[model samples]
Target chain A: MSFALQLFDLVGIFVFALSGGVLAVRQRLDLFGVLVLACATAVTGGIVRDVLIGAIPPASLADWRYLATAMFAGVVTFFRHGSIERMRNPVLMFDAAGLALYAVLGTGKALAFGLSPFAATLLGIITGIGGGIARDLLVARTPVVLQQTELYAVAALAGGGIVAIAHALGWPQAPAMAVGALLCFGLRFGAIRRGWRLPVARGTDSDS
Target chain B: MSFALQLFDLVGIFVFALSGGVLAVRQRLDLFGVLVLACATAVTGGIVRDVLIGAIPPASLADWRYLATAMFAGVVTFFRHGSIERMRNPVLMFDAAGLALYAVLGTGKALAFGLSPFAATLLGIITGIGGGIARDLLVARTPVVLQQTELYAVAALAGGGIVAIAHALGWPQAPAMAVGALLCFGLRFGAIRRGWRLPVARGTDSDS
Candidate 1:
């Protein structure tokens, strides 16, 4: 990865960890639990993506930067949770940025590894949502990505699809990735501000 | 990776799937949800093990039989829910058998892959509990492995430790694996029969 993208990844991981730490505090998890949830939420997506593409040990385990960033975020949030929760909109925005970057990055990596477009796109979506799903599960909550009204995964899918399409067309990667991330961030921002959401299933529970 | 071990792995996966299916039914999940939970719970342990050990695509995803067995178990449980629920003790026993086998198998694989004994033993414990943890998390329940006084992981740890120790001593694997599995199964069985449990922390909530 380029230095710029790698830097973006650390920022994203830090924000993700902070959000997880906040949730852990709210759930009354002790310091150890908070750290676990924070670190897990920050790295699970990347680890899963790397594993799928045959990257051994994963970046989170192989390098100290990602884990240190997560731990730092966790500690900060643990100490300043009340203030952080009060700035929910900003946290969500940062989370959207992280999601966009992960989706784009995962897609690019998969394509570079010779995965087909369909598989690459799917893996990208997994990368974007994997961490949040893991964090929610650890807290015994239904993942927000699976919620009827959430638009999280769709935004990720769009970002991943963009990167995949760009790669398929032999387009310049850096610009395409930037555009994809912007689009994802925009979608998430719109969702938060305008209540944009997926249609809820209206089917009867008896049959399903 | 031998034929016998592969067959044993299939049996373990089948039993694990059945347990997950039962849980999904109790949760009132739909057919699709039941199948997903069943398959996920059956394969998660192996997948995590493979990913950690740099095994790509994972044997569970690579082999169609693993998925088919999980789906078949889910379907059987869906149709025979009442009968299966009636055989509670038998189901638990099967689950224990699965756990024992996974612990032994995971340790053996890790050791074969040139991991340190400590890491191998840790991976083995993860392999035994990973599926069940995923199953519980999916249903929005706290994982049983983290529950106070549950002896599940300790049992797997013991089993894994045995294999690790044996490998360290340059002993033949087959006999050591069999002994480890037996010891694990016995521990679980004894725990069930005699209320065996680990001690709980008695520290004040104010401090931790």
Candidate 2:
């Protein structure tokens, strides 16, 4: 079980790191900036969750595997950015897959740590989106999560809520997590394919 | 000692929150956004420090006083922004005060947590600047800390380093902390007054 969890975490980290590295490349940041963003995006959310839950030193810092995965992703993205840019759809799919896994795993971890269901759900969404937010911030841009029309945060909330509910209902862990991940991935994929967007606020009278 | 620490924390939170609120008003964010940015700016640094050191739930979340301070600052800023804007120098002074206090407090806490001197110093700087970075990010701006001309991070590092060094030298905790704070405040205050700036990186041939 631990090995499987580790594998899942590594894959998620790799994909997230790649996204960060690609962004850094686009921004024309130095090599150091690219690696820093990759590592931060890959692990910062988990680190934030661990800290909030009182997990000291965070698994990302304590365990070298996570760092290694981020570095590997950054290197690959740096060298093959041209080809990777051409494969935008595949990259987006990978990002969605990572988001789904992170949401489920984050909720599960928060639940294990005795967080309230509401808090756990929030943490799960944070885990899914926190790294991306951090990445965008470093590059001086608004986070995509905050933008209207993206189903990112909404999908994370849904997936996290499902995990929390399943745990509350005494559902088996593995299958429950799987279902949560699938739901998150499906929603995100559909949003991308259909260009779905949430409604924006109409201009208030004060604006005019 | 605990009471004094709490008082210091509250003051810092108030000042930071005020800065955030003022920024929000300038950005034309609604009331909710103002409050969110205020609270985020005031508490994020300490939260980041607590998490890094394995302090659970974060003092900001655990203590209602911190939240109240943030809200109070936000409300005041929202209603009296014109006057607050006129008091720009005072606000900058308050921000410097907050930065000094946070740097000293953060280093002290990290040292208490048994972190190495280098790590503790870094944490102190993070505690000083983290909230501001968070504030800028939420508003979709480049962090002032990363700006080439800003001496903000440099001042933080110096103050934090003093605290760590004093601790390493077996100085009395209270006096050592006081000295660290004073140094940070003086440096920051001087920088603002004199328009001191760090050197920017020279443009490379690749740029041309």
Q: Among these predicted structures, which one has the highest lDDT?
A: 1
Tell me how many clashing residue pairs each candidate has. 0, 0
**Model 2 chain B lDDT-worst window of ten:** B27-36
Worst 10 residues of 1 chain B by lDDT: B199-208
Q: What tens digits encode model 1's per-residue C-alpha lDDT throughout A1-208?
A: 7788789999999999998887777766655456667888998998888888887766675566787799899888767776787899899999999999999998988998899988999999988999999888887888888986679999999999998888889899888888999998889888988999987667757667
Q: Write the residue-wise lDDT of candidate 2 on B37-152 in tens digits.
A: 78889989998998879887777765657777998998888778778878999999999989999998899899999998899999999999999999988878788888965689
Candidate 2 per-residue lDDT, tens place, A1-208, comes to 4887778789999999999999999998888888999999999889877778777778899999999999999998888989888988998899899999999999989889887666687679878988998898888776766555567877887899899998888888888888889999999998899987654323322432
Off by over 4 Å in 2: A2-4, A204-208, B1-46, B52-54, B59-133, B140-208
Worst 10 residues of 2 chain A by lDDT: A199-208
